[model samples]
Target: MSQADHRSPQDHEHTVHYDGPSGGWGSLRGIARIFGKEWATPAALETLARQNKPKGFMCVSCSWAKPADYHTFEFCENGAKATLWELTTLRCTPDFFAQHTVVELLTWNDYDLEQQGRLTHPLRYDPESDKYQPCSWEEAFHAIGAELRRLDPTSVIFYSSGRASLETSYLYALFARAYGNNNLPDSSNMCHETTSVALKKVIGAGVGTVVFDDLKNCDAMFFFGQNTGSNSPRFLHPLQDAAKRGVPIVTFNPVREKGLIAFTNPQNPAEMLTGSETPISTQYHQVRLGGDIAVMLGICKHVFAADDAAKAEGKRVLDVPFIEQHTQGFGDFEAKVRGTSWSEIEAKSGLSQGAIERAAEIYVKADRVIGVYGMGLTQHVHGFENVAMFVNMLLLKGNIGRDGTGISPVRGHSNVQGQRTVGISEKPELVPLDKIAEQFGFDPPRDKGMNTVEACEGILSGKVKAFFGLGGNFVRAIPEREAMERAWRKMDLTVQIATKLNRSHLVNGRTAYLLPCRGRTEQDMQASGPQAVSMEDTFSCIQGSIGLRKPASEHLKSEVDIVASLAEATLPPNPRLKWREWVDNYALIRDLIAQTYPDEFHDFNERMFTPGGFYRGNAARERIWKTTSGKAEFTVPDTLDAAGFDDAPGRYRLLTMRSNDQFNTTIYGFSDRLRGIEGTRQVLLMNPDDIAKAGLQEGQMVSLISDAQDGIHREAGPLKVTPFSLPAGCVGSYYPEMNPLMPLSHHDQQSKTPAAKSIAVRLKI
Candidate 1:
């Protein structure tokens, strides 16, 4: 074994993470309560409600479940009460805010903070009144417009939250540009921007290549760094279907989540009656943090060897015909794989040759296979390279845009992809921008601006003057909380177009405004009629969505209206820009979108009604890729030098993650039900041997400080130690809480996603 192998198991002797929280002495009891908590599974019912029942409302969180499966009482544990809290007949009117100061309200926890109920009108923070005073929409827009006009265009940043509908997102971008700024710092910039940056560059498509139907046809499936059971429960049905059909599901993650192993289909009445759950992954690999790329490389190497062996035997090999016709750079990629040493592969991946070979056998035996990966695959230092490795494996078997064998980058938000499709990007291509400019009759600024992180950084430096958001808690989502808060204070105007209140509304710029927008579950009626917006699923299939619930407040306007009013208030009068008419009709937006990208959006209205959804960007259909050479290119990552991080004194690797109930930076209380964690996000998960080696007993409190060469120090304070079965030496903790420990600089070189998996830290007592 290589020397790198020597330190990991020994390191494991020191730390580990759990699927749930367990406390000192009372862990058994705490765990039992969680298991017995009777948190009824409502995902199946909720999904069913959206379709068969025709409620038109959809959960803003997950996407795998069919809308027809939605139920009226249906609510997942995470979905429950909170949805009511946001969508209920509750109200937080201007009068309510008249009693509370902005400073006074800051003391409330997020749940307690927003459970104060929903906003009923437009509000502006009044320092004089020491409270948020109700303001007229026109009044607020003018105040914000004046503030925006006073600043350099580059000084203004525009952010889009994922859950915002396509209509809203398009207007948000339009107004930001008409207001003269392109700093589109959005939710994608935080969550799966890595996937977009990686996959688009790798396979010529930014979104996942597979559709929902693709799941049923795959011969072999991989669950890479994804916990489908809780994070996306609707996927449990497909996983069960795939597993029962005898297709193997292989998983590689730091922890062994039960959902990946066996999942009870809340949809399967017989299975629920018998307490029988279908098993997903035939095999699971607990890859150490930062170890996925190596595991992937090893898989690619095995595929290379398998193809060679089949060639020697003169047998019809795994997708050789597909590879030859559809993919490029296979020869160079194969050579690179062949040159990789077995010793290095096993040592770096923390896997045995036996395990890798077993996986390789499974892959080779399958004719049609799909690889499903999550943040775990894309949130690393070499994230793009990691994605390339995944694509390389598919190309070896020719799995591009096929029935089942394709790449699925499991998305975290319901409509993050849709936001991008409808022009929410900071960097709009010249072609699209030119068309938009022609329609609006304004010379659109073509500056490539800052993303989310860069926006925070720019704001901190006072380069950013104002921030306008369609929806989202910006200060909470961006990394380095301290820097983000500090930067936000410098903004001249901060606007939040949202459904409910979040901490970010409180991240007050010099002048702040909150304009509530209708949600996915709320009705949107415009002059044209009741309008429905479309969202792209993880499968790259675009489908339409309409809402059924009444607006939380009668005053709430659709996101389209908010953008149109803002644009009118900001831009000089131009007959070319018909703001009122555009907001009144969404079909015009679709027409403009189709005009901007005829290749992708041609006859956009014709396809929007198809409940089956529309196919996007058909590189697979033509077997012609749009990469550098019009073919998928083979990329070889330089060997990463571990000596710099490992040789340091008193240092270990730290990985930041999330609990199932939580979404993004929104902390849904302090319990990780699936992993059995409760009461705190401050615990450090470690292996048994690592506990002893660190001279730390289970539940011991310790601080963690970073020792990276990059000159950033990470603080993991007062972490409670718990032992779990994870591979040794790597430590795990939940995110946002863990964000401070991962420096903004420690990101994927290509995608700029924080190498959230491979942070180095010094344990403290």
Candidate 2:
């Protein structure tokens, strides 16, 4: 029987509607609910007004760029929700912590724990009392510093979140290096690291080539493994406009998402009132999970076939001229495409040859094509190969250096791009070691550092002694959560600089400190009056953001202030580097960044005042290939069929996904209105055929066992099975909840990113 047939009113808090256009009154209702849950109408309205403004704070949601031309209401529903959540007046004080023990809090799910509210002050974990008690900021810092000094620098790991501003990120790297450590891991390491690794090899740049304006004018756009409506709602505006302008959008994902199919702009009053929706994807191809590489190859094969046909007719359809001048490896790449059998492509991609041809026809007909992908493409075992395949497809048409053509990876986190720009990478290549030593008067380490996955392994292996996090739930976000948490307990000290309490805070070491800091919604008054921090968007636009709302608590410190103070306590006085000056005047930090990266960030402080901020120059954007070959080079893909990895009996492929109600590790609410799930985050989305084959009923609860080669125990669930429209042999589950099923050692070889999108599993009914 179908899940719906057995589902009772008590089984779900709300009915699950399978069909509806995304982003209409439904989005408005969701926004209203956020305000109701977190803030009063006045506070919500005030916070919404300030979001994404040039003079105000940037939204803490996704890192999609703001338009060059500013709109009054630029924020999306989730953006508004994030602003409300951050600016909420509710506080979780020392008394709240005193009422709960770490062991008791560990039993609470992620949402319930964070929903308690914003942390008001610094706290230290007391092992004797089994609870967190209030502690002074100075004492907290001194204690952390003492521990840092007690251990070897190589034993300490510095982890950064994308929410950190450019100023704070720069300071963080500087502090880590000066204090004699090079182990820097950031949010990028877990999400877009594959993009960085793949793109830099082909284009000599780790970031996307196109700016936000490129989307408005692009002739055709291809979305691979990305749900634009849920992950980046603000990005849908340009897409909606593109559709209205008659541009064809092609989407390739496992599930047919409502956002990609059609969207009614909440910003448009007429559309919202009349219920008129803009159809987004002209052609939607539901490729199976981990099938992106095969699908990309199939499309390229069709493009080649068209090129040969056009040549036979004495006409050039492909950009041969541009390709000859700006790209390399066309001959070998074309040969491979020709050699790739249509049957293999169809079998691997789970799409018919006709469908692939149809999408290819749309791509070939357009003068300029833009490729956009997200974690869905980059969170696989062959993720680096997957991204390289995308770049290869773009290079075939000479799409990298044009008005409306380039590769754009939809990066997560508001400042994830900025974090990398300001040198939060485990592999810091942008700024040379000699130059950094010369500029900052300190010898920076040249060796590559540990990534998120490697950092986890380091801790478990006893190589890492101390762990420090700046604004992310590191323990909860990574895979093999239980093992990582157990390893974390072995640390000499753990420090978390955060705005709110999360699962990471509860996963304590012998000595742990929760240094509550001011969120982006709160005003940061440094020694030099009010300050503004700059962040780089996915499109490489750097803009200033200053908070206007009052501080959540008087005891809370700004990120910049906290980092500066930590540096003061940890490192001996370095006359050459004035931590206080940079902390007090954020402009000074930008000036230093300009000094460190003169070519791209020249006149950085002055550029902040520009209307939408300046675009950091991209070599590929101008058709100047900075690669070793002096041209974009096509690389071969590792696997045409990701399903080949499942060679064992009773194995099924699983994809970990974010619910519409969640952003990254933060669960906003239980209901995923877009996906039609309500009041539960533990449901497993599966195909009915798969459910039947496994001898499981549609609504039956089931446990998932990982097919990890390491022989480690990794499992999750008692997850409610909701038979959906996934491809046979594939299942979907929410992330962070399903994170335990991911093995620490199972990651992309090139990038060290956990293969969160593709896990081999077996159903246990």
Candidate 3:
């Protein structure tokens, strides 16, 4: 029997997914977990082995978008498993829903809620029937249009997921704009808005300041909170190249990622047979979660001191020649670093003076350095500050606008970068606004729109009326799932542009429509014959992708077509964005992008022919940073708060994380062997000493509850307890399950990203 048959209401509590070791620390267990314990279920492995036959297809969810020249098991374990999970013999067909009401589906666990398989047809909720009945795509579109026709254009908000292609995202923005709405709430709001916001303030462009080729020449790397080995294995090749070149890469996080220590590329024959792993981190330091600011300051102080000592000893320092020529605000920044005390740094960072100095020594000795960050840096209350501090360090050594030294924000999704280029943003400069207004003939609104936080508050207060999700499951992915659901119900209408049924689909509005669209793995045929979608990589390179798989359903339309249909339905008789022309020829969409963002994509057609990808403009490399002063400026940090902590007695600060086999909201399997977790998704990690102090034993049942019932969604009961060497006051669990426990209020002030790393909760036994 499947898991759904046995679970009770409490089973939907915080999910505890596991990632077994395949080649990392738990390599033996990982292998055993996949090949031994899971051997009985060989459907996914079989599907991958079958598809391993030289299909020149690029992965849709990650940055490994190269021409598939050698497709021999080229897919990682997680990617393969995801493919298997997709091609599963299991089917969540129309018959399955015939018996289950939308309310019943809401009560269903997320795992089983979705594993019902690819949606076979479009669906809509009938209040009288209480069940989701099948509907045609055309009917569903009309239903959405009729409801949308009733409201003011600005009343509706558009939410996007990273899964959309440039063509689709561009079409989405066009549809929403034509309908007169500018509130584009997206997954970016929940993850990297801080990086974008901070970069826009300092560098003028809100994108990574470095490229893929830059990794080869870097002399040292400062990486924080990103577990590249598991989340996205493609990054390992470049990191390994840096390691072999003797470049020291330092890591600072609350928990040691097994992949960060040593990772073996499954592609290397020598590594595969001998099990030889490439050593990654030269220096690994564990800092308390949310202590990123102190840790960064400590590094800056040491670097500044090293420069002073070098000058005192009459040694050459700073490419000082370059520093004076290219940067500004050094004197003030140096004064702040020097005036800062090591005691304060140590206290706030939970690190000793010795460790901080060692990190600084590495930073100073390297001729060129790169600072790489991920969600951990962006998912805190002070995330914007953390990103700004990283830029500050790059400026100190005149390390930017060059080949090796800069800041790289390793984005989690494939097209989040492309979406920005396609105009999926609430904060756009006047140039694009004017250009679009000229092209479409509707004077665009220049006023800033609502971000994720503002959107949530607006929904709760009955300011925003309707919610339109382009592709993401926002209700589940947003901060504080419970509150979001309540806010969702207050809306006049909620529409989901989706592929399959998910928990968010059950979150019905006065009227809800689930419009099925083509998946990333399938072909997208448009009016101009079969079309290829484009996406930009972490390096700001735009490349085209042509999905090879047959679509899950024949009636499903591409997201581009759906957007166009919606545009035709809601616009003032004659639309402004020329949605008709853009959808007819996606090439026209590219031409518009080229004209709108001229500095980046000058001639989109010329670049469209190359599948390798097109690189965006580099401000640092041009030494033409667009800050107000026309030079790189270092901003001062906030005053120290050394003794301040967010937890109380029995109340642990919770961090919601992912496993090896998972993406942002997709589950491939139910195990995380690398961390030694098994059987269930309700487990929590803590310090062994802390567990003992609480009189808790291994495998003991317990419950975790937030101080207030206002936002927490977890119905977790007493669960088997597990202990690891996590920070004394912190606890860790997987997301979607943990999403309920976190609130929209507990977020980085500037970014509004959920503080998944620091939330106060109590344990019950």
Strongest candidate by lDDT? 2
lDDT of 1 by residue, 1-765 (tens): 123321234233333323221111122233233333323233323432554123244457654433333434333444432343345455678887878787777777565565556678999887677677788898988987777677788888878877776666777777777777678767777767888887777777777777777777888897678877556655666677787888888788777775676666544457555656555678887776766667777877777777678778897555767666666777777677788888887777777877788777788788887888887777776777777777877777777767777888888776787778878887766227877877778877788878876776777778878888777777766566766776676677888887767778877877888897776666789898887776666666666777766677888888888888888888789897778987788888877777766877788878865555666765743455767767765566565221114534566777777775466766545657667666777788777867788888898888887767677555757888888666667777777666666666667776566676677777878
1-765: candidate 3 lDDT, tens digit per residue: 123211211222232222322364343334334444233245435444433222233455665434323334556555554454544445566788789888778887766766776677777878788877888777877778888889887778888888788888877876677667678867888888888888877766688878767788889999887877567666776777777878888888776675666677666778777767767788777777777788888888887778778989898546676668766777887788889888888877878899888888888888889989888788877787888888888777777788887888888777887787778888746238888877777766666667788888888788888888887678878766786787787788888887667888888788888787777666677778777677787778777756656677787788888888887766667544677777777788788777777888888867754644668777766778777777776777774421124546677767778876567787645766556565567778776767888988867888877754464445444556877656667777787677776666877777677777676678877
Cα-based lDDT at residue 74, candidate 2: 81
Go through the candidates in order and give each one's C-alpha lDDT.
Answer: 0.69, 0.84, 0.72
lDDT of 2 at 214: 85
Candidate 1, residue 607: Cα displacement in angstroms equals 3.7
Best by TM-score: 2
Which sequence of candidate numbers ranks them by lDDT, best first? 2, 3, 1
What is candidate 3's TM-score against the reference? 0.91
> How many residue pairs clash per model?
34, 0, 13
* Model 3 misplacement above 4 A: 1-56, 64-74, 84-89, 575-578, 609-611, 639-647, 707-719
Candidate 2 per-residue lDDT, tens place, 1-765, comes to 123222221223222344667888888888889788875448668768867877777889999876657677889878877888887767889999999999999999888888888999899999999999999998998998888889999889999999999999999988998887678888988899989888988888888999877887789999998988789988888888898899999888887677887789877889988989877888887788878888889989888888889999898767888788878888888888889898989888888899789888988889899999999888888888889999998887888888899999998899998888877877756556787899888888877788898889899999999999999989989988888888889999999998888999998888999999998877888888988888888899888888878888899999988988988999988798898888888889898888888887899888875666788888889887788999888887657864337545788888888877889899889878887888898888877767777787767888998887678878899999887767767889898898899887768888888888889888877
